[model samples]
Structure formats: C-alpha cells, structure tokens
Target: MKEFHDIAWYVKALSKELPNDIRNPAPQRLLGGLAYIIVIVACIVAMNKFDINLVEKLMFSLVLGFSFASMGLLGHEILHGTVVRTPWLRNLLGGIAFAPLSVSSRLWIKWHNTTHHAHTQDEEKDPDAWISLEQLVKSPKIVRWVYRLPLGFRAFVSFVSLSFTFSMHTMRMFFMYINEFKSKKLVVWLEMLIPWAVWFGLLFYVGFNKWVFMYVIPLLIGNFIVMAYISTNHRLNPLVPINDPLANSLSVTVPKFIDVLNFNFSYHVEHHMFPGINPKHYPLIKAKILEHWPERYFHMSLVKALITLWKTPRVYYKETEFLDPRENTAYDSLGNGLDINNIKFKKLKSV
Candidate 1:
C-alpha cells in the first residue's frame, strides 16, 4: 500500500491532466436513466404480451431483477452527484430511480449520505457498523444465531420488506414533524406518500394487474439484489475505527462480468473516498488509487465472499462501547449526543 502514499508524488511528477470529457457526468445519468426505462418497459411488455410458462417467468424475473438492481446502483450514483452536474438534476433522476422501488429519497439522503458517511464504522454513531466478533461472542444466544445467518438471505428478506420498512420510517417522521414542526420532516412525508399514491393510483385506475406484476415485483427483486450487494460488500468485514474510512470499507477486485452486473459498485472504498466522482468514473479513480496503496485495498469476488460468509460460524457480542449521550463525542448532532446505549438490543425486531 506504500504505492498509495506516493499518489501526491506521482501526480506532481507526471503532472498529467484527466480529459475534460471524463468530468462530464450528465451523459452517464441520461444513459443510465434510459437503460432503466428500457428494461422496465421490456419487462412489462413481456409479461403482458407473451404466453409464458413458469420457466420463462423465472428467467424473465431474474433478468428484470438484475436490471432493476443496476438501476438502483445508478440511482445511488446520482444521489452522490456522480451521474450529474447539478444537484437538482441529480435529485430529479434520483426521485425517478427510487419511485418504482418505493424508497424515500429524503430518508436515504439522511441515513446514507449523512449518518453513514459521517460515522463510517463508528459502532456508536454509524448504523451500518460491523458488529465485532468479540462483541458477538458476548451477545445472547439468539443474537448470535441471527448474526450467524448468511447476510445475503437477511438482505433478501429486508428488500422484500421495504414497503413495511419505509412505511414505519415515514410514520416516525410524520409524528416527529408534528411534534417539532421542522420543514425537513415534511420532505419525508412527501417522499413516501407521493410514490405510494402514484403506485396505488396506477393499480386502482389502470386495472392492469400485469403492470403491477411486471414493474412492482421486479422492482422489489431488484431492491433485494441491491441490498444483497451492499451487505456482501461491507457488513461481514472487521470493524475499523470510525475515523478510518480506508479500513472500514471494502474494495473487491471484481471481474468484468460482476462489474457490469453491479454498475461497478464493487469499488466501494474508492467510492467512499472520492464520492464526488461519478459511478462511470469509479474504475478510473480506483485504478489511480490502487497504484498508490494496493495493500490497503481488499478484493474478493462476490461468489467467494458469499460462500465464506455462509461457512463462517456464529460469533456474538454482549456489550460493546457506544457513544454515551452524555459524553462529548464528534457524533453529537445539533446539541443532541448520540445515544448508543439505546442500540443494545438482541435482534432488529421485524417491523
């Protein structure tokens, strides 16, 4: 990884400038959005027009599912400003990308961009932190069992349960808004209700069961794929200290096949470090960064990672250090300290 330390030297010595074309992100956003629309339309047409057997339905479902997953990945890029030049443009595209999936853009922005990014692997503040093997060892037996299950399966279930998941968040935000009168809370309601209304309205007014089946089912499946991809990429890794983004995030050296399937989200660490760079530019940035710090990077194929996680034995935790709400930590938000003690629960109870 010493090579990564030499990045500044290389940049200074080579003094090479990247192409202006590489900086133009609008085209990628347009292309990505178009790809999503085409795939969705194709799936709808197939379901509605063709007299398909179970085998065909299964195959088409997988194809459409993977396509929807890729769409979500592209939508993530837009949210990070990787696919567009303007925030408004990215927001517009992001809204479209999440509409079918029934996710809240506002909630995603808060959880992913704000909380997760700021805290990274901070067990106290980062909701996405890796619960350590030692911590797992001390956990209750049930906690150990749940953590031991294949993360992919857990992710699949979570994806299928998105409607319930976001609905709860929506309700929480609704009450919070009512209590606090914060305008930001209103954005949450708008984000959730508008998509729900549109989807339900279509089902009610159009009377097209095929559209519901084609678009919504595939959308949920795609959401599952995205969740699986994310869990495999990061959750099982050893927890790094909150301050260290490099150690906390994983960077898999995926083959071209997987990269194409995932929209190149495999380079997660590089993505975290240079979030401003678009998804299309991740490969370029990763190559440049790898030239500097190879050892710091971790690469595993998706299949290999999944298999290893499945084969691993359960490790549970009982008690881990968390930011005390009374303490002065960097995680304090708006005079409110992060209350890690509140996180002491056996399992994430299903909503």
Candidate 2:
C-alpha cells in the first residue's frame, strides 16, 4: 500500500494529469445562479397574484425551496473563489445568492471556508462534526433521547431538522465566534440585516399567511435540500486529526438531474480537494482520483450514505466506533448500522 500523506501531496500529483483549466472559474454558471434566483422570485410573485389553493401553493413552494437551496450552493462556490476573482464582486454575488436564507456571506467565509474546511473532521475542532461519546455524556438527558441516535425515535424524524438546522447552525456560529469578528462587527451586522430587511419587508407586503408560503415554507424546503448534501458530506466519514480528503470526505453519487440542479456539489471530495476550482470540472477530478487512488478514495450512492447515517449512532467512542451510551453498544461508524445484534461492542484501536 502507498503511504498516506496530506491532501496537498495528492492535489499536486493529480494536477499533473488533469486539464490545466480545471481550477478556472466558470462565470457562465452565474447566469444559472441568476435563474435560480428568478425561480424564487417567480414562485413568490405567483403565489401572491394567483388564487391558488393549498395544494397548488405547496407545489410552488417546493419549487421555490429547491431554487433557494440551489442558489445557496452557487453562493458556496463563489465564496470559495470558484467563479469570481474580484473580492468585491464575489462577495456581492455570493451575498445575493445566499439572500433567501438570510445568511451573511462574510460570516460564511469565516465559519465554513476558514474553520470547517480547515478542520474537516476533527472531533475537537470541526463544529459540524458529530459529538464524541464523552461529550454526549455531558449533554442533557433529553438531548440524548431526542437527538440523532442511530436506532431510536430520532431515527424516524430527526431528518426534518435538516430543513432549518443549517441556517440555525450558521446563526449560532456567528454568535459563537463573536470574539473573532468583533473588529469587523459592523460589516457583518450590516450584511446580515440587509438580506433580512428585504425578506421581512416582503413578509409585511405579502401579510402573514402569504408570507408563510412565500418565504418561511420555501426556506424550510430550501434548507432541507441544502442540508441533505451537508449531512451526507462529512458526517458519515471517520473523524481524523490529519487532513486527508480521501480518508475524511465521502462523495456520493446523485442522479444526473439532481447533480445538475445542485452544481455538482455532490462531488464533495473533489470540492474539498480544490475548494477554489469550478465544480463544472468536478467530474474530471473524480476520474483522476479514481484512476490514481481508487483504493483510498471513498464513493457511494447518496441514498446509501443517507441510510447509513440514519442507522448509525451520532456520537463516536473511537475514531471508527460509534457509541450509543444508553446501551453501551458500539456500531461501525462507516458501515451499515441497521442490525443491533450484528453490532460488535468492543472498542477498536483508532486506525
């Protein structure tokens, strides 16, 4: 077997064989981003103008929701320098793309681009990383029962939290890192309030009932669309101290239609490999990785990743062992976790 090294070593090797334009921004994708925004706008306008029933309203809301989430990934990409090189233009367009969720582009850069990416799956460091058994013990009892347990009541409906949890986590991270943004607090607050003002203004314009369908319900759907990818992105992978994209990131295959809608964000391992690269080129990156490091790179279907996540305990006892403290049972963190009887309870050495 080849010796493992940091992600940079792999990137350097991959670049030699891949096309030179792989890292270049796809500005044309910005038109697609604008189209997504138009979808959100059209949905809201039609909801207010037409005498649509609840069923019709909901159908429109679903479309709006997907557009909101889809634009979100475009914002995520632009923030990563995927499309625009000019910092001002990048942040401007990125902020617009993220406006539906009222997420601040600047804060996203600090929270997601800087911290989360820097510490992909470090238990102590990655804020989005799942809890450890020791930490789970410290949490409240109700949380232990109701939160994302691999095989309990949580398994049934905790998935819905994805609808709003991504934005909630984003807001929480802002206050959580208040100290770091203290100097630039004004810009941060201004950016946050600007998008929120437009949204809230629409709430009054549309009135409460219409606003629910227009903004609130659609945002929830949007959150669900975005969080589906987020939940499957790194949470299923084993936590690692060393930053190894191949070992720590799992890229799942979605149908081509879904992939196109989300800007190929499913090529998550590729995104981690080159955060600054255009995702339009992600398929090529995937080919190179599979060609050179098939043994180390992890790939699975999106459905399987979601199923494995639903069945596995969220708290890790060891790097590879997931523990549900109530039963003192250890399930394989990276494997199918459906059958409790098949679970091996011993703690394996962190590999």
Candidate 3:
C-alpha cells in the first residue's frame, strides 16, 4: 500500500473550497459556555440559599458536573485558537474552563494541541496512543492492571476508570512531560493551583459531605464526559507512523442536542483535519471530507464505539491488530474478531 505521508495537499485543496465562515473567528460561540459557568454558580447559590437536602444536592451536582464538562469543551475550542486570539485572554478563559478537571491550559496545550495532534497515532510520540504488547509487557504490573481493569478483560467495568481518566492523564502528562515545557513551569503552577484551591477550599468551607456532592463528584463526572470522547477519538484506528486523520481518527456521531452541547465535538476526524477551525462549521467540513474521501472517513454511533472499545484488548500486536496477552486472542482495530489462535501474528490477515 502506498502511504501518503501527509494530508497537506488534501487540506490545501479543501481549504480553497470551504466556505469562508469556517475560517472566520467566532468568539461569540464561546460565550455560550458562560451559561454553564453561570449554572455552576447558580448550583452553589442554591446549596446555600435553600439549605438543600441531600437529594437536592445530588441533583445540583449532576447539573454542575455536566456544566463543568460542557464548559471545558468550550474552553477546548478557545485554546484551539478557534476564537479569541489574545494570548492572555485565551489562557485565562482556557484555565477557567478546564478548572473542573484541574488541568493547566499551558501544559494542556503542550500535551494535547502540541504533542498529541502532531504525533496522532505514532507509537512513541503520541502520548494517548495505545501501547504495543511488547511495551505493555514491559510496563509495571500496576499499569497492566490499570489497562485490564477497565479496557482489558473486564471492560464492562471501565466506566469506573473512565470517570477519572482525564484527571489522571492530565497530571500524568504534567509530571511526565513537564521537562519539555520547563519555561512555562511557573505559569503552569499558577494554572494548576487555581482549580485545587477552588475545589479544596470549597470543600473545607462547605464540609466534606456537602463538597463531595457539589464539587468532588461533579469533577469526576466532568472527567467522564471528557474521557468518553477521548477514548473513542483514536484508539480504534491503526497506529500509523505518520499522521492521517482519516485512518488514525474516528468521528463518533452524537444526537442533535449533544452535537450542539458538545460544540460539535463528535466530529473527531473533521476536528483533527482542521483543529484551528471553528467547530460550529465542522458539519460542513465533514460533508466536504465525505465528498472527497468517502472510503477513508469513519463515523459511527457513540454507544457502538464504546461497546467496540470495551470488547477489544488495549495492547497492539500489530498496527491493526489488538491482542489479549492472556488469551492469545486477536481482534482488529475496530474490535471485529480474527479467527487465528496460537498462530504467528505475521500470518494474520490485515484488517
């Protein structure tokens, strides 16, 4: 198979054909996220004003959690340079937006927008890419358990892991990848401090029981919202040496209301194709992608994507083959079963 190395030519051609609005900066769309922020504040106010009971607090926390996650996505768009190009304002808004998960906008840009986007599914460079079976075996026992507990054998219980995966990875990237961005360390410290102070200070002020319902659990919920998409974004695709949005990314379809709430985030491949473009215009871009590369694009329901992710092993034996080391079983990148067992992986057919 001929590898295209990069999609620069395709993007260049498509750029000329796209509507001008796709390139225009629409900061106003980000303003909608303010409503989520407002709702979170409102939830806090209600807890104090009504002296809410446990049941009422639970309801408010659910709203707060969803609002936190939703607003964070808006911040994602902001950080992506989709709108608001002012350096200070962009980081400020992004910092606040990602507050629920205690993510530093500066570090996030380094980890996500910089590294993850550049590397995509590159096995070594892309932090989020699935590891090879050899690498998995070399990993610590606890790390192996981490994969198996949620994404490996008993995958049905993965939600427990997903709820905090974003939070875990954000800190992991911070501690692990901080050396790469040492110059920004000071700002990242301030960025990281803001969320911890707000959430923990609120906890001490409001009491553990109250804080757990209001902020703690809500933050966990926010993490779940973020990871649910993150997990499905690229894991199903083959780990290519080069970045190929069509082959290395999968676009999950959400319902109309979710598409609106999530800032059109379900259009994963479209966003990867043009991360800087306003997500509002992603559907149009998606249409253009289909027109150009119908066979290359991937779109599926959110539920189906999650189900398939659960059924497959997290370790890669081949670029397109997933394997469970314990079972000697093989599945394709998309979780379709392969009929080979106890056979050399080289003899296995390409998915």
Give the Cα lDDT of each candidate: 0.57, 0.81, 0.79
- Clash pairs detected, candidate 2: none
Off-target runs (Cα >4 Å) in candidate 3 are 1-5, 144-153, 334-351
lDDT of 3 by residue, 227-324 (tens): 89989998878788668788788899989998898888899998888998989998888989889888677778888787777666767876778766
What's the true lDDT of residue 283 in model 2?
A: 94
Candidate 2 worst ten-residue window by lDDT: 334-343
| 51: Cα error in model 3, Å | 3.3
TM-score of candidate 2 versus the correct structure, residues matched by position? 0.92
Models 1 onward score TM values of 0.70, 0.92, 0.91
**Counting only residues 3 or more apart in sequence or on different chains, how many pairs clash (N, Cα, C under 3 Å) in candidate 1?**
14
lDDT of 2 by residue, 174-210 (tens): 7887568877888888888998899899988989999
The all-Cα superposition gives candidate 1 an RMSD in Å to the true structure of 9.6
Q: What is candidate 1's lDDT per residue for 1-351, written digit by digit as tens?
A: 111222234344322544456545645456756876788778756776788876777667777767767766776777876676576666777777777665566666666777677766556676555554455557798866665455446545544564344335435544533434367667666776787797677566545655546556666577556655665555444444434434556666567887766677888876776666666667776676567656566656666654444432212122122221111111211002212233121222221
Model 2 misplacement above 4 A = 1-3, 140-150, 335-351
TM-score of 3: 0.91
